[model samples]
Target: MAIKLEKVVETFYQKLEEGKIMGKKCTKCGAVEFPPVYACNSCGCWDMEWVEISGKAKMHSIVMPAPLSTKPEYKNLGKYAYGEIELEEGSRFNGVVRGMTKKKRKEILAAGKLPVPCHAAIYQRDGYKTVVFDLDEE
Candidate 1:
């Protein structure tokens, strides 16, 4: 199971290196899983295939990271928040969203804009690439 999961991670990073976001779609249930899991969370199916994601998503909920509990690797990300992200392809997952702050979160929440427009972004780390999201401007 570990080896199979490792292969999925490798494929995901390879695609990210090519400037493409990939997800796994269950062949049986037509469910797409982001962060590319080996099995379908929807129907528990292991039959999946790689699919290019649209990189378009919406922020459902946001939680500011506590300063004391922050990870060192994410220091370079500046201001960000962990949010429930729903992809255009119907896959939902938690992801780091850039350009977030306490004031902005309050305003967004007060304005009743729970699900705001956001898009996926590929960020270069120390030696690898990862995906993040940015809130779309009004």
Candidate 2:
């Protein structure tokens, strides 16, 4: 039998390569897991299937990267921040959201907007590509 975690990662990448954003949907209960998992998080079911995601999400909060604390690994991920993200499928997570600046974060907060529409976008890295989300318009 394959390692559950490893299999989940493998399947996720395979789908991404095909330009399809896939997630795991539990058969035991109607729960969707992004960054797909082997077992259901909601009901602890092992019967899950690869389901395409709509790529729609929202930014519930923003946490700007600290100044003067640069990581060589992130030299390429220009202007990013760690923020709370929620998929339209109902999964919530914290991820790197690029193109976020301190001023922009404050501006967004000042507008009294905590959660804003966002969509998944593929980001190129030195080793492999990954996904990030972009703020959407009303």
Candidate 3:
């Protein structure tokens, strides 16, 4: 029986509402897929199982949001930017990172910190919870 894609998404958000970050790990090749996919991106396997993520990740790259392109719904997320985030489980995805300013971005680049340590933060938006990254102070 094939699982519906919508069901996977529903389950992901449901788990988030319960304050547990979940990911699907492939039993065949041990690859964990963040955002909880029904199929594994690695090794082409559908044998995926739900696993809790550590909420730990690293920021690889940053891209500031363009003024005109910014969404009104995200206005509350002041000083945010898009970045390439690599989860501790080894999955890389583009995610919204909070607490980013132009000065901070410059400093991180000047200091040669390409992959700064960050942790996941669950943010409530509208009526649903979403995950975002905050740069770790340590």
Measured over all alpha carbons after superposition, the RMSD of each candidate to the real structure, in angstroms, is 0.9, 1.8, 1.5
**Candidate 1 per-residue lDDT over residues 1-138, each given as its tens digit:** 999999999999999999999999999999999989988999999999999999999999999999898988888999999999999989888999999999999999999999999999999988999999999989
* C-alpha lDDT values of all predictions: 0.95, 0.83, 0.91
Candidate 1 TM-score, C-alpha based = 0.96
Ranking by TM-score: 1, 3, 2
Select the stronger candidate by lDDT from 2 and 3.
3
lDDT of 3 at 106: 95
Clashing pairs in 2: none
Best-matching candidate per lDDT: 1
TM-score of each: 0.96, 0.90, 0.95
**Deviation from native of the Cα of residue 48 in model 3, angstroms:** 0.6
Candidate No. with top TM-score: 1
Model 3 residue-pair collision total: 0
Tell me the deviation in Å of residue 85 in model 2.
0.8
Supply every candidate's count of residue pairs whose N, Cα or C atoms clash at under 3 angstroms: 0, 0, 0
**Tens digit of per-residue lDDT, candidate 2, span 43-130:** 8998998899999998999988777776667788788888899998998888778788889889899998888788888766676667
